[model samples]
Target: MHKRKISIYCYLVSAAFIIGLLSISMFISYSKDPTSSAKDDNQLEYVTPEEVGYSSEKLNEA
Candidate 1:
């Protein structure tokens, strides 16, 4: 029973250590480039129908 308790404690400590390491790495990476994980705020270029070979005049007639 004593050995089993020690084993459980070891497992818990190992899991905690792994989690801490992962958290630290994640924090460092995010701190370096916080915007890297965020969605792009840049506006997309607007294209006209004529630019893609679609006639605006034909669409207007329809």
Candidate 2:
């Protein structure tokens, strides 16, 4: 009787944990997408062109 109770408890706990993890993952991905998430929340920071393999000087020359 004790063994059966323990197994049921374990199953419930595992199911809860899995559901929580899935929800968190979905939230994170949904919030990261620019089109799907709010635009005001996803502000773009200025990054140097050099950091992304483009030369800032050459860009300025154009």
Candidate 3:
């Protein structure tokens, strides 16, 4: 029937619209700056306890 065909066409168009929106959103999310994820100004620094005035022997006892 013609009505059935129209219903199918509408369903296909709606599905395609949803897929397009999802792909656009995904692309926007992935294209953002990678460094923007860091929320803090103080990043972790690699340093030994001895440099901070802590003895290695005392750490090993714990």
Candidate 4:
């Protein structure tokens, strides 16, 4: 009976450790800068195709 209690405590401690590591990993993954996700520097610009030297009509044809 004493050995069974020890085994149960070991399992509980191991599970708690794994859960703590997973929680930290998730927090780090979610704490990144939102703007850093954009691939292009001009991604935040609100210009039309014609303003950037591209024809809107040509884009519509595709």
The TM-score leader among the candidates is 4
- Where does candidate 1 stray beyond 4 Å? 33-62
Model 2: how large is the Cα RMSD against the reference?
8.5
Worst 10 residues of 4 by lDDT: 34-43
What number of clashing residue pairs does each candidate have, in the order they appear? Answer: 0, 0, 0, 0
Residue-level lDDT of model 3, residues 1-62, one tens digit each, is 99999999999999999999999999988885776766655778878999999998999999
Every model's TM-score: 0.51, 0.51, 0.53, 0.54
lDDT of 2 by residue, 1-62 (tens): 99999999999999999999999999987774665544565678788898889998899999
Q: Candidate 1 vs candidate 3: which has greater lDDT? A: 3
Work out how many backbone clashes candidate 4 has.
0
- The predictions' CA RMSDs to the true structure, in order, are 5.3, 8.5, 4.1, 4.9
How accurate locally is residue 55 in candidate 3, as Cα lDDT from 0 to 100? 93
- The positional error of residue 34 in candidate 3, measured at the CA in angstroms, is 9.3
Candidate 2 — what's its lDDT?
0.88
What is the clash count of model 3?
0
lDDT of 1 at 13: 100
* Tens-place lDDT digits, model 4, residues 1-62: 99999999999999999999999999988885666855766557689998889998889999
Candidate that would win on lDDT: 3
